[model samples]
Target: MSSIKEVSLRRATVADAEAIAAVRVEAWQTTYRDMIPDTYLDQMRVEDSFLHWKQILQALPAAGDRVCVYVAESEGHIIGFASGMLLPEAKFGMQAELTAIYLRPAWQRSGIGRRMVQKVARTLQAQGAESLLVWVISGNAIARNFYEELGGVLLHEQAFSWDGMDLKEVGYGWRDLSVLMASVNAMPTSSSVH
Candidate 1:
């Protein structure tokens, strides 16, 4: 078992697309099991998403742009990632969006998620963002609780369809980027490595 202490995070590059895609696909399957349609998860392929990830990484943020992606790695393999972006207009009064954040099931609750989120928060804060928001499946209690623990407030819920499955996504917002960043920084990543 790898300890959270073994993880290292850094900005992701185009070369990391495949590994990042793999993590996303795997995490979605593991984390969203009954919470989502099995067909949606079953059809997810790292290879199929490889180009999508490549395009995201290939598109470098222009001047004044806030889009960013960070990857968490251990043993030279990418284990997780967190990505965020700033749209041209604010939605739900939040300029920054936590576009995506996923980790292997085994990696959750080990402090790596906090570390990845901190990187995203710092990126958004540096880009003059006052706050950020993330959308999580309404049925994902674990993810919702994690965001709540980090000072996110339940802002709203929007109904959407995924692979023909009706679902509600809850919006979690942090009104202050600094508060989120500070709270994440204050967390102990458990230095005792096993």
Candidate 2:
């Protein structure tokens, strides 16, 4: 981490759709290479992601599944992003499902991912989400460790099929979103570089 002075987190705009899509595609390749099929990754279309992000950006704030996307910008470029939504049937009163979280491959271990996830927790709590939950491919040891180090608990493991392969995913959860927030908020702000 370079100790950047300013890393801004702001609500994503429609203009950010293309950038967001690029981040997703790149992150997916770096983070899910072995977990997902190359065929699936190969077929991923930026057009699809553009359309998806466009819809998300255009939705009214009150729309139930309308995700609140946040981008972490440094030096006029987006290094990471996070997306989350309220889960209606959550075991906890108001739980948020973290749909996606990704940082550029070059930015890993720079604490940007940690900051983004913490921001997501605070954003979700403000929206009445009492808990936070994330799904990770079971084989992804790196991601599992990251969440665990961030105070997430290994809740359960479930099996599903993806790309015609049997895949098992692990669920990591924060029963109290505040806990997650505290961990993120307590971080040294001096980590960000300008």
Candidate 3:
């Protein structure tokens, strides 16, 4: 097995949009291969995704809005990214949502994802968000397990259509930011892949 390298997490910038988008697309292709339709995955274009991310990264937040994007870097290359914002309409009583988190396949299960989530949680908490929620593709067992391991509680499920196919999403919620924060903090700092 290849050894994991140290990863540094930092706020994402406009310049990082392309890399972030690439990571997102690659992750989707790998993680959702069986869960999503092949045509949809095949049509996912990096340029389109890059433009979307660029717009999101460049947009100015409205009053009372709390949006953050972060990227994980190792050996001077971006390996993953995560983004979150305060939810306008709280779901499951959660004030914030983890909009997205994606890592390259090789870098997964290396403790980088947990660190990204913890950092996003702390950022959200600082913005006055008391609780957090994340939506995962219902059939994605790996993702579901990852959230559960991080203390997420299954709160709800919703149906949606993708590429003419019906799909479901599972919502995972943390009712208290403090509990999540404390648990993340309790982990040894050395546990980081670095």
Candidate 1's error at 102, in angstroms? 0.7
Query: By descending TM-score, how would the candidates be arranged?
Result: 1, 3, 2
Task: Determine the C-alpha RMSD for candidate 3 after optimal superposition of all C-alphas.
Answer: 2.2
Clashes of 2: 5
RMSD of 1: 2.3
lDDT per residue for candidate 2 within 1-194, as digits (tens), equals 44454677777887888888888888887788877888888888778888988888778355633367888787788777888877767743337888788877877777778777877677777777778889999999999998887788988899988757788998999988778877766666545532
lDDT of 3 by residue, 10-123 (tens): 988889999999999999989999899888999998898999999988872442248888899877789999889989888889999999999999888776788888888889
lDDT of 2: 0.78
Q: Better model by TM-score, 2 or 3? A: 3
Best by TM-score: 1
By summed lDDT, the worst window of 10 consecutive residues in model 1 runs over 185-194
Q: How accurate locally is residue 44 in candidate 3, as Cα lDDT from 0 to 100? A: 93
**For each candidate, C-alpha RMSD in Å?**
2.3, 2.8, 2.2
Which candidate, 1 or 3, would have the higher TM-score against the true structure? 1
Q: Tens digits of per-residue lDDT for model 1 on 74-157?
A: 878888899998757988899899999998877788888888888888888888889999999999999999999899999999
Assess each prediction's global lDDT (C-alpha) against the native: 0.85, 0.78, 0.85
Clashes of 3: 0
State TM-scores per candidate: 0.92, 0.86, 0.91
